[model samples]
Target chain A: MTTLTENPNVAATADTHHGPAKGLKRWLYTTNHKDIGSLYLWFAFIMFLIGGAMAMVIRAELFQPGLQIVDPHFFNQMTTVHGLIMVFGAVMPAFTGLANWMIPMMIGAPDMALPRMNNFSFWILPFAFLILIMTLFMEGGGPAFGWTFYAPLSTTYSSDTTALFVFSVHIMGISSIMGAINVIVTIWNMRAPGMTWMKMPLFVWTWFITAFLLIAVMPVLAGAVTMVLTDKFFGTSFFDAAGGGDPVMFQHIFWFFGHPEVYIMILPAFGVISAIVPTFARKPLFGYASMVYATASIALLSFVVWAHHMFTTGMPLFGELFFMYCTMLISVPTGVKVFNWVATLWRGSISFEVPMLFALAFIVLFTIGGFSGLMLAITPVDFQYHDTYFVVAHFHYVLVTGAVFSIIAAAYYWLPKWTGVMYDVTLAKAHFWCSLISVNLLFFPMHFVGLAGMPRRIPDYSLQFADFNQWISIGGFAFGLSQLIFLALLIKACRKQGKPVDAKVWDGAEGLEWEVASPAPYHTFSTPPKIK
Target chain B: MTRANLVLLRKLVLVVFGMFLFGFALVPLYDTFCEITGINGRIIVKAEDSDADKVVSDRRVKIQFLVKTDAKNEFDFKSNQKFIEVKIGELSEVSFEVKNKTSSLQLAQAVPSVSPGTASLYLNKTECFCFSQQILQANETVVYPMRFFIDEDLPEDISLLTLSYTLYQAQSVQASYSKSELDKGAS
Candidate 1:
């Protein structure tokens, strides 16, 4: 058999030449999935920073008993825009970028199934976010209604710029749907021969499921936003009480899409963690088949539990009970996945590598978040907790500590593999410890304040909740500042100055990706690798 | 059958099973589709404007806005030039002014169309805004009335109307951006 260099294939040929120096055209008109993925990752990182700045503002305003930094109205807008940016602009796209970079390498495909559609998806995000950000300058300011965009709030009393918010959400939904389609089609149709479905990596499997969820629910979100626009501007009464339409019906539709959207953010993280945990622990993933089934079950149960968000909006007793039970049922599968993660690390070579450290924090912290979620699932308790800082704390724990932590962990885990150089291990661990401690400091007290009868989305609170708010603000600033260390670690890794990494850095990695060379290549496994 | 045929058969079974699963998944969605699109139990309320019923409460009278398209100038409210009615369209808003001639602090809520009862707008207590709650501090007189018209697409044929208001003490739930609040802690 001829060597790669002797045969002179595209990858070997390109390696010989300097090719084009990285410049503007290399970004704009490129079809390289890795290049495109890097672009997406950097874009999401910037949006995350912007969204985090908004969070800092929100925390600053809420630092004391009375409104200290901003008016209640502007605070409301900050919370609204923060949720929108994080959900649509940051977490989801970050996962998609990871998928674009890793999935083809993992599954032994040369490129995504629909590369041009992939390009369209990535480019649409910047413009979509631009439109949304521009709405802040519109007359009467950006959407002050909460991110849920409940009716009567988003409708009758909305600012004139609600139309822009609606259209921007439409573009974002389109971008997500197309990106998901690319991921799914590439996985289903382009997997290298012998890479059987059952033998595929968990990251690919979880992402496959996530892509399906995106395609299914994003359209519903689009439909919901379209109705909002029409109701506000075009005089449709889809949500007008005077027109025999109930305002609460909008919540029903939005969360039907939204609850799954939450799953979309984390399912890929589940895949990433599943892959990384076993690699570090030196154990086969405990209950691999069960992990796959559990993900599917979580995605399925996500649909029936949307109304748990609307429990306090006054549904009938039966409706409340149905939603509560359905919401609680999700814990079964979620519990299975969590149990498997711990089981993988049981009595194995458990090293606190930077990626493993973040994953470990995610396990403990996300479980705390999950337990709070179960508490919130109880309709009776949720009534007391609804629209309170407690609910805010619960989701931030799930989202920030859970979803955001997993993204950071995945970044560290793959940074060496992606760059062919190890990251600053000491600095990486410091970032993790700081994040873990500060994030808890930030979100933990919200439970107490919320339980003390403080409602959410308010700029000020009663004097009783002041001390916890002060502690929480300190934690928020530390958490925000700690992320700067991560940015530094990433920049250092891209410079490729650490120890040289092997093709498979971890001892027990069992995927097609680790079987390939480090730093991957512009094109890899073009002829498809044999799975068995 | 050869091994190839066996593999083909398994693939066929899996495809069929997937189809069944997908079809099962779609049943509830089909139901939700019907519910959202009004193919299922949907109720629509329409207003038929006939004429303004001049109801006299205490010592003053109030005129309700007419939602009738063909009701030919029944109420003599001052904004009649802007009031156009449709046979069967949306509900329109209408209001009339009543003087609190007595030297007492008077409060009122501009209660309109009882079927959907109460205007959706947050009621602000300002001196002269047309038939919302007018709280006149003593020895002061203010106009209490409604400012609304019918949604121009009300159903034709029915011709009856009732406008009601209740006078009571008012408390504020209005959350507006104050300039001081906006500039809070800015120094």
Candidate 2:
């Protein structure tokens, strides 16, 4: 039973009591994974607030319909920036942040294999967001195309500021790719001696796959946006038909990157759920091997299903059918993951801690989101659903309730470990219940309205859709405000004046993370633990 | 460095370079796909009934009607003039001039529906295209730009096709105004 300590050269001589780096130098030149991880988390939180405010503006406009608060154009800008910020700035970074904080501790690693690059990865984000928000003040205003930035709309008719949007996205993609590379390398190289591939935590495995997906597709996004920039400013007609470019082709290229991007948002959430469920249930994870395979299957399926988003854009029938089948197949693996979580909870001593509560909610609500996704995968069904409030409902269910919820769950589950202080159970559970109910109220009716043919991205809608839109707005505002409770809880927890936690925070916890003391130090695993 | 460490470094360089190559080749590969999917617009030659009946002179007279929109609501609507056929390899700017054909002053956006319902006409302003929706006085003629040239890739079988605009009048605040609403417009 050899451990990192067995290698005295690596362990006894290694700095065990390494505190976080000091001053501006600590932030700029430090390679500490936890510091970099915190940087990512704080940056993501700020972007979430900014992006959330944009959503409030969007909801305010849609509250009563008829283009009440903002012009359809500015409303569009809100929609575009809101989407870009949330997907890249909020969800992706949150997951990356979690990966940074947890992976080394979970897998018994000393540190991320490349830590300087990790710092570079995080700092790039604020600048990217700043450039993007600045575009709102530009000559024609920021990008008004939906986050998808579908062609002709993005290319031919776009604003002068779209060039700025393109450049900012390029930098964001670079950051994501670098961050992902660091994850993949650390996972591959730094695992403790006895921590075999199967022994790795689900969080690490899912991120390992997610990182690969990010690397493969984010570059494609950068390339797609680059073409748009050239098309707009350089007189190239990559999307201009007069110059022999087809606009539909731009869609093909963009979605090739985009569909995988969707999976990138959710896969790590799957990993987080997998980790949280077993720990709370006081049982071993059901079908652990299957969970791994299912994650891999989802990532593979992601690439082929990009065309599902473009079905109504008039793709060839064969392409449509191929993408449809590929997309539906994903539901099988996703369903397996869900079943495993529920099955783990079955016949076990399960108590609803804040983390467990959010986890359980994720299982139910994400499945609901998954079912809608299955419905959207059917080409004929999607033809009816595309660009409608239904698509909006489907994603918000998965994202706000699905990915964002998992992040909250993971936060609560690990907060004790990260801060050595237990959160207020009453307040944390209150946040969970309010979020779950309000989120459903917000997004569930969108399915009905979307099915009834309410198009999305329109500042105003026809009278028939008015009632549901109003209800959705109320739910949205409530959900947005409820997040403030989470912010307050986090602040209170970080102050370290709450319930004291033992080394293993959860009764059924496994993995190197719980093996370490709560409130993980600046440098953990200076000597990696033996897994076996 | 240890042998294992050296192997790891080599693998890292290869993987990184491989990824770089994949990214560098992406645009060209996408361009190839685009070229394959792109439909070379047809050259449509249709004589008026006079040419069709052989009643017109052999000396060919080419008449081009420029299609243009008023630059108001220009981007609000998606337009396609791609199906409109012109002579192959012809060096003429086929313009669709959209006159505020309405009697009352109207701010109208014109889209040159070309490029197979996928291409939008990008309008650059002579000055600043400051207002997306132009303010046209009654009986004012502000020509919108939907200028494009017939590509050299036109096929021989196709002939004359028409580029027509069925312009819809936008709802203007002058005709129907509100303070809260007017303040929110994207100028």
Candidate 3:
């Protein structure tokens, strides 16, 4: 086994012996991390567009409250498929793509510890999604049961395509498990000699914790879908009340997987913001050790707080109290993270670059989502908010503004390094402003309508909710269109049509990644770089 | 993978497998939790009237009876009375009438649940029709009796309690029973 040493001038002996293979085989057979990262990213973008179109169908239907576009059953399919696609296909794969591209570069590693397995992990995702999307063209229509796919709704009362949903989810779980395993092995075995745990970049640290979480919870999800499959086909009574099983038990198990899944989506975003906030502020990160500890605490607390999602399922009083308190405890570490970001920008030479603007918006907007989450964590109040549009508003805020925005920020921050050309600043800023205004228009009114008793997963609403629904639909359209601007900007940059960038694109950026040339060579750190 | 790295990866794989089993283990774990807290309203049936010699209380508690049958079950089932007032610690008898409307022999089992779930521990059954499966020939009708009592230690605030029983086809139960019987014959 070769060990990395702290030598700053090791680039002379670095391996750049071979160039990439040409055409389709390059993507299909390559073990290069950057190439694999691009493949994962482009795939996630396509899934995002498809999922967004489903959301468009939903919004168009809800524009007038009486099923203006699609029928009610089809409407249910839209909501269900939209949720499954965005969470699994879009957001998760995008993060994994970013990890693939960035972790090795940031930690000064030659490549992922298990490169062949990384190739296998990326290839399985498309097949998984194919089975999932194909369910829509089947006889009885795709899974109309909400994304949660609760028992009975997904089993006895479901369409024939329910079996496909279960299998698709199983394959997705396999892909995620393999991806997470590769990340854990890469970060664990491949860091440079001087890159001790504390000295590692925050992005690497966050992915380290997130990978552990994925390994722990993805199997529980596998167990859950397995039970659903058995109950539907094998006549098992795992969720059948008449057969001595309880429906509420299914909720407990799913949420045990689900709450941690929420963290898996967001924790990496925290790492992204940590890197961006410090760079734009022209200062070192505030309370670095505290941020790492806070992240670990949040991941640990996620396990005990799963039942907060099941507060209305008639749990015992003690059980309710325990989950409520545990859920609320998450806010402390989350508060520390928010405070650290704000302090990092306190009294420094702050810049309003595209990435910085997104980071700032993330701090403000994600906190709004967090505050709403705190309200939902109160068990008694959740009874009012459960299955309502307010619940919808809260999650969209965290996911769209919180997770998706950070991803956009990371793209803009690293585009120069990836493509060797600078992206159009004016167009990027326009995209950000349009999204910021329209996403609020899309989701903010949902809280009011939801509080006014507008139930989710329905095609029709009372006339009282008609006006807000119209405005929300309009906002949805604007947000969807705004993404096209981002697409245009990405294409221009990737074509290398803009001016070439220096190795360190941002004046304030610091890391091993900045030490390499712009448009990072296909094989980086053939001999690992030394850190002081 | 190096030997140590291989060992670590194997350990992580084991953890994943262990958690998967833990998911299934949650079923039995949930049952044990409910048994301890009596939060799911599931009742425990005793074979004989061991608490018959206990003193009866003067306090009266309103007991409401509810009965239902599975959607696929071809049986007509109903309670003798909708509601009754019974004194705590006094053994009370209630009967359910059931008729198997199917054309063939069928087995059925009743699963009992109580409302105000905390009261499940206080409501004990000395003998219940739910204790075992009942086999009925075509068009057979029978009155099934359940003997139970609200313990004297019942909380004062709960003046009303609901007892519900749902009947289900006992195919799996019968299958297991026949397997055990076959074992007995062999032994």
Candidate 4:
């Protein structure tokens, strides 16, 4: 293994001192991708639980729909923080963590191209969330304006903590922008010698497009928050109608960043599903090139179809029609990707490994989410569904069962390689089954209540919605508690208490990542592997 | 980082900055878009020809006037008429009565929004109180007049349009009053 004479630089960097540094110092001062990746994963896990707890509080208060536990303002704060923490703290960071760990390994690169910036990006997140979380304890309390934070609600009528909310968002934007730049540069500069653009894995391709979308929109979010800051503290009338600025303008700016931000969360899930379906089915991904095109088309269409979110905000008939048509057009590319996933699974010797189970659920459940989204895209119909619980159900199906299930699948898929041990198969399958059943029970009924005219972001509801709300809250609590099983399983695997795994952890897994030793020698591809 | 990496980072940084500016740019961009399409019912009233000869149609539109005062503003304001029937392209005048209920002299500005948003483009104001800030003495009451007409091209389907004006306390005037009060206290 010591081929120092062959490649002296590789030998020097891959010397015996290659494992992680001592304890806290390793995570603090290290620029290694794997260590940083682990840090990101653990951090995201904690945020996920915290965000989940907020959701529980919301569910508890809405359990009987009479505000039994908390006040309306606190409930509003819970809802707002719950969404913020999940989107920025849990989901996006989790994807970035996956990217950090897997991108270098899959591409046959030694490390991310900009390692120091990677460290900077990861570290900024905790502090941003700290400031955001601290706001709940402040005098006026955290942002009560929904995560959308429309004008007046977030500005003149908001509490004192709105400024802190704005700044926390700014730092988060900086961290995301830096993270995206590092990804784009690494992929652009660090692929193995034989790996052409076409030869790259689906995960890498999806992330490449996702990174570009992040760079394009995160700054717009920064700008939107900045205006919110000015309007609240400084003397800017950006969203105040009396000062000749329109409140609807804030919606335009927000959803412009916002709509793409939704895709940014899910595109990587597509990548994860694309990888898993082929592995479990023991076939190459069908229409891989077309899948790539579909992902790109979705990202492109995301930019123009933003106003579909603003259909009820008084758009002209032509404007509404244009956005309606554009929004519906997205279903085409999205449909192509779904078709390709099913095609890859068609008649193949598919195994229901934990990862495969989650992937299959993703295909079916995510398509349900997509169909709801298409219904929401119809301009007139959306007028009824705009702020309803139906909209809430649609996104949660996509985000919770869709994006989050992919993260879990990726975790199970890669856990063996990361830990050098096989997880308990029975426990992993049970966890998947619990999550699958409980997540549907939680979000599926939201569509029915939403159609029956239950509005979102409120502490109490009419007694008519009582029965369904009780079931949804029960499902929510079960889903929340079930995740602890995942936590225990992950902790057990990390302690190396399970049976040892081999270099190629799965029988059908294909990628440079599987070619390395289990527990993945702290520094892999010291000499870049030749493709073909 | 290598020089090439540094250059690429710089270029990407510029793109981020450009998008940040683009976010702010969307303000004016939205305004122009709305103005052109009358999407949000924000109408820019340019002085239109008020000549009686300009009447091209005898279609009558029911124009409803609505007035609201901000919660923070101490003013009594109401439209003289709840609704009026006016022929398209024929000039009409409507007045709103405003009285300063506060002890101090105050200034107010009215912001107007037209509903059935498509009708905003057809509702022309030859002269309107919303064009300038109105200053009133303590306990002063005045009838403010707005002269306007509906264009003959007003959407055929829209027979009724609601014109609403919300009066807000002018910030500049409030700031000046506060400063003067502080100065008097010091003296």
DockQ pick, better of 2 and 3:
3
Per-candidate interface DockQ score: 0.03, 0.06, 0.47, 0.41
Residue A371, candidate 3: C-alpha displacement in angstroms: 0.7
Which of candidates 1 and 2 is the stronger one according to TM-score?
2
The candidate that wins on lDDT is 4
Candidate 2 or 1, higher DockQ: 2
Stretches of candidate 4 above 4 Å error? A1-14, B49-53, B172-187
* B99-181 per-residue lDDT for model 3 (tens digits): 99999898887878888888998897776777777888999998988788888888899899999999987786444332432
Q: How far out, in Å, is residue A282 in model 2?
A: 1.1
Model 2: per-residue lDDT, tens digit, A398-437? 9988999999999999888877778888789879888888
Q: Give the candidate order by descending lDDT.
A: 4, 3, 2, 1
lDDT of 1 at B35: 38
Number of the top TM-score candidate: 4
Model 1: lDDT to the true structure: 0.73
- Give the per-residue lDDT of model 4 (tens digit) for A1-532: 1111111111223555766555466677879888778778888889999999999999999899686899999999999999999999999999999999999999999899899999999999999999999999999999999999999899989998999999899988999899899988888888999989999999999999999999999999999999999878877788887666778899999999999999999999999999999999999999999999999999999999999999988887888999999999999999999999999999988999999999999999999999999999999899999999999999999999899999999999998888778888888988998998899889999999999999999899999999999999999999998899898888778767689888888898899999988877778888899898
Q: In model 1, what is the error at residue B55, expressed in angstroms?
A: 35
In model 1 chain A, which range of ten residues has the least summed lDDT? A1-10
In model 3, pairs of residues that clash are none
Chain B TM-score per candidate, please.
0.30, 0.32, 0.89, 0.88
TM-score for the first chain of model 1? 0.96
In model 4, the Cα lDDT at residue A251 comes to 93
Please count the clashing residue pairs in each candidate, in the order shown: 24, 25, 0, 0
